[model samples]
Target: EAGVAQSPRYKIIEKRQSVAFWCNPISGHATLYWYQQILGQGPKLLIQFQNNGVVDDSQLPKDRFSAERLKGVDSTLKIQPAKLEDSAVYLCASSSVIGGEQFFGPGTRLTVL
Candidate 1:
């Protein structure tokens, strides 16, 4: 079985620009998550999904960030009017159950100037 997959392994954009990232989770997995990792900090959960329904998004900035896991298999994360502080690696992870071991993708690294 394949692990998670993410696109545009790297991105560079100016502040106020828009960027989108894609993720395809493992087969049969029921949970998906998006995270942001800054240079010296651990990844912070931005959102989570269970079979196409949002499970958590408490830390996500609704004003500039959004995500969706349509069909419960693939997901997309978008950042509009990106900020310099938003430069980080956007990671996608998946698990079969809540609190289970999660499988992670290579991540999309964004550099906002």
Candidate 2:
């Protein structure tokens, strides 16, 4: 099966700017997730979706970040008024079932100057 797909492998922006990342999960996968990996740290789950319905987003920074999986296939994550601290790799992953094995995308590296 094909792995998850993400876009704009790399991005550079200044503080206070806005940026967006796109993700396409594997076909037939019912669970999707977004994670942020800061330098020198493990990936942190930002949000999770179960077929277009949000399952969890307690870790997401809602004040500056937003995400959605409208059709259960594709997802988009956006950060407005970006901060230098937001510089990190955004990863997208999907699983066939909840709590099942997941496949991750290449990730989008965002640099906030």
Candidate 3:
């Protein structure tokens, strides 16, 4: 069996530039999530989706960050005019169903200059 997928595992950009990350969750998974982990801190949930519908995004920076789960499988996260404080690990996670353990990907590290 295959595992989760994440793209552009590392990225470096100017503070005002833009960046995007992609993820593909495991098959048959019903819940998908995106998280951001600042250095020295634990992962913080940015958004969650269930079958192409957004379930949560209260913590997401709507002014600069946006994400979507398409077809309930593939997902994408984008940041425009990236800020220095936004440098962190962008993680994509998924679970089989309610109460299922979330499996995380390798994560995409963003460095802002």
For candidate 1, write residues 15-79 as lDDT tens digits: 99999999999998899999999999999999999999999999999999999887888999999
Model 1 residue runs over 4 Å out of place are: none
* Every model's TM-score: 0.97, 0.98, 0.96
Compare the candidates by lDDT and give the number of the best one.
Answer: 2
Between prediction 1 and prediction 3, the one with superior lDDT is 1
The model with the greater lDDT, 1 or 2, is 2
Estimate, for each residue in 16-51, the C-alpha lDDT of model 2 and write its tens digit. 999999999999999999999999999999999999
lDDT of each: 0.96, 0.97, 0.92
Worst lDDT run of 10 residues, candidate 2, spans: 1-10
lDDT by residue for model 3 (3-99), tens: 7789989999999999999999989998999999999999999999888999899999999998987778899999998999999999999988856
| Pairs clashing within candidate 1 | none
Worst 10 residues of 3 by lDDT: 92-101
Taking all chains together, the TM-score of candidate 3 against the true structure is 0.96
In angstroms, how far off is 104's CA in candidate 1? Answer: 0.8
